[model samples]
Target: MAYQTTLGWSLISSGIVTLILKVLPYDSLWWGLLLLVLGIAILYLRIS
Candidate 1:
């Protein structure tokens, strides 16, 4: 129950949040890469 509500739901929510951030006006491509990496880290932490 905790995994379903916390990890699963948080992953989905973070994905949407990142998607919105991507659509925002950002001049730096580096930020996008950082965000992608951070997303991966989140998934890794959750699964581990």
Candidate 2:
């Protein structure tokens, strides 16, 4: 129910923000990996 609620887009936006952080000025692989994993985790939760 939480995901279906009005605030669901806010959750997705957070994930998008995470992805953007990884996108701009690539310097550390670890940072990009962290964002990638987090984005995947968010998508996983969204589907389940």
Candidate 3:
């Protein structure tokens, strides 16, 4: 239950961040990659 909630929030937050990054004029490839890595790390930590 808690894990599901965490995963849901993480996805939501990552989506929002991705959208915001898309809107910015600056290059976001690195930022997006960083966020992806961070999100994966978070999920890995939660699972273990």
Candidate 4:
């Protein structure tokens, strides 16, 4: 149950980040990659 909740929140947060990146005026590969890494770290921490 806890795992599912964490996963759901992570997914929602990632979705929002993606949406924000798309809405931004300029392309930012570095920022997107950084956010992706951060998201992965969050998930890893939650699992551990």
**Can you write out model 1's per-residue Cα lDDT over 1-48, one digit (the tens) per residue?**
987889988899778867877777774367677777998999899999
lDDT by residue (tens digit), candidate 3, 1-48: 999998999799878997999887768987888878987899899999
Ranking, lDDT, top scorer first? 3, 4, 1, 2
For every candidate in turn, the CA RMSD to the true structure comes to 4.4, 5.9, 3.3, 3.2
Q: Please state the error at residue 15 of candidate 4 in Å.
A: 0.9
Per-residue C-alpha lDDT of model 2 across residues 1-48, encoded as one tens digit per residue: 875874888788768877877677766567778867987999899999
C-alpha lDDT score of every prediction, in listed order: 0.79, 0.77, 0.87, 0.85
Once superposed on the true structure, which residue ranges of model 3 sit more than 4 Å away at CA? 33-48
Query: In terms of TM-score, how similar is model 2 to the real structure?
Result: 0.45
**Candidate 2: stretches off by over 4 Å:** 1-27
Clashes of 4: 0
Reference-based lDDT, residue 38, model 1: 92
Worst 10 residues of 2 by lDDT: 21-30
Better of 2 and 4 by TM-score: 4
Which candidate number would show the highest TM-score if scored against the true structure?
Answer: 4
Name the runs in model 1 displaced over 4 angstroms: 1-26
Backbone clashes in model 2, listed as residue pairs? none
lDDT of model 1, residue 34: 79
The number of residue pairs in model 1 that clash at the backbone is: 0
- lDDT by residue (1-48, candidate 4, tens digit) is 999998999799878888888887667687798778987899799999
Backbone Cα, N, C clashes tallied per candidate:
0, 0, 0, 0
